[model samples]
Target chain A: MARLTKIKTRKKGGATEILVLVNHPMETGQRKNKKTKKKIPAHYIQKMVFKIDGKEVADANLGPAVSKNPLVGIRVAGVKKGASVKITWSDNKGESGKAQTTV
Target chain B: MNTIRRRTFLKGTVASGFAAVAATSGLLRPTEVMAAAWPKSAFKSKKLDKSIKNLFGSSKVTASKAIKIKAPIQAENGAVVPLTVSTTMSNVEAIGVFVEKNPSPLATSIDLTGATAFYSARIKMGKTSAIHVIVKSGGKLHVAKKTIKVTVGGCGG
Candidate 1:
């Protein structure tokens, strides 16, 4: 909600490239709290679905291993310019975010 | 409280010793589990082999020269390591990244429909270990690996 997911796209002929960056803690649940000294609950993105013009192109299943404020990308073909590229990601805590861009 | 803190401190560090491997991987212990379409068993596995097996549904991966893994030979920081996995293999259905020494070796698995076999992401490294790239093409898993030395452990926090 605070840090929105950022979607970037580039088109070269029929090939399209998409880069998605989301801001999340991506906690591993193994670290200790500075004050309370308790383990921080694991919080991270669980699923990232990429769609091109409303059609699913890539689906990423993630875990806590991803770095904080994750950055992931993919390249595809057959996408035309001016088409919409969208990314929707949901975390383990049932929270989600979305972003879209035009190539 | 002192002993517990010490144990946790040792768990967050990879230079402490290999004896802490079990405790180190335990750092990724899933507290809240997963949502739909997420692979729970694969991400929960401690060992690299088991995680790979649970991810692509088989440990039967063949060494392939087609898959290319672009990552640093040595990572100054374990918290954020850049990794790019690309392959010239045809009919690629999915790609998976694994950190051999991480508590959860399975970093992320991507199912590609219209996308190419090229994928890039940043992942955490628990220690100096092997990073494996598994490309699923034509229903078979093709694999490649690169060992990256981590100066600091990321699982610490």
Candidate 2:
């Protein structure tokens, strides 16, 4: 199985900042295997959602252009400490993962 | 007790059109409740102009001087080109990174909140192409582009 996403949340004043990192190959399907020299299929994260206490605050739409193991930083207002910050993503090949942390 | 009240208040705010203001502010929440699916056609476009049009609803983007793109002039590897886009402008609601030469031109689209003007990512380039950084702020669009030459191939088959 691939690596799970990493999530971290911190409280700043009345708002909370969430940071996320996803581990993925993000293959462009244009690369060739070193040994077999076969075209590797394209696989990359297509979408990501950031939910706070079950409320969506932000999200990102990605493409094959995104690098392997992407990192994103987000800030949401009016969120307090001890709030639930959950990050989830789905790739092009229908693979998905989720990670959660508290603020 | 507090969580239930907060949830109900949010539900009421959505019905009261406050979510519309939040959408414009780049903190959209109602869209998550109504539609959770990502924009498929926008990310699947092979053409640069069409992808821009599909995502931004317009392909007419003017080059601006306020936007800054921090990327290598010549990428060592097309598989992992580190990119950082920051803007000097205010009220920046969203930032999009587009690779003009890839099969899918739209690399990433990130909606921001609480006064953010920067976005960074690692993008794959199939070949040498122009990188367009589009910043949507104050209900308008500003763009900056730079051509990055790929040294070693990564995206081409």
Query: Which candidate leads in DockQ?
Result: 1
TM-score of chain B of each: 0.76, 0.74
Model 2 lDDT per residue over B1-157, tens place: 9997567556544543552454345554422422444555567788988877666666777789999898999999987888878777888877788988888888898776542465667788888999999887786778999999998755755
DockQ of each: 0.42, 0.27
- Roughly what TM-score does model 2 have, to 2 decimal places? 0.73
Give me the overall lDDT of model 1: 0.83
List ranges where model 2 is wrong by over 4 Å. A8-18, A32-39, A75-83, B1-36, B113-115
Q: Which lDDT tens digits does candidate 2 get at residues A35-98? A: 8989876777877877878876656788777878887766676776677788889876556899
Q: Specify the poorest-scoring 10-residue window by lDDT in model 1 chain A.
A: A8-17
lDDT of 1 by residue, A6-77 (tens): 988887435677989998899988899999999887778989999998998888988899999999989988
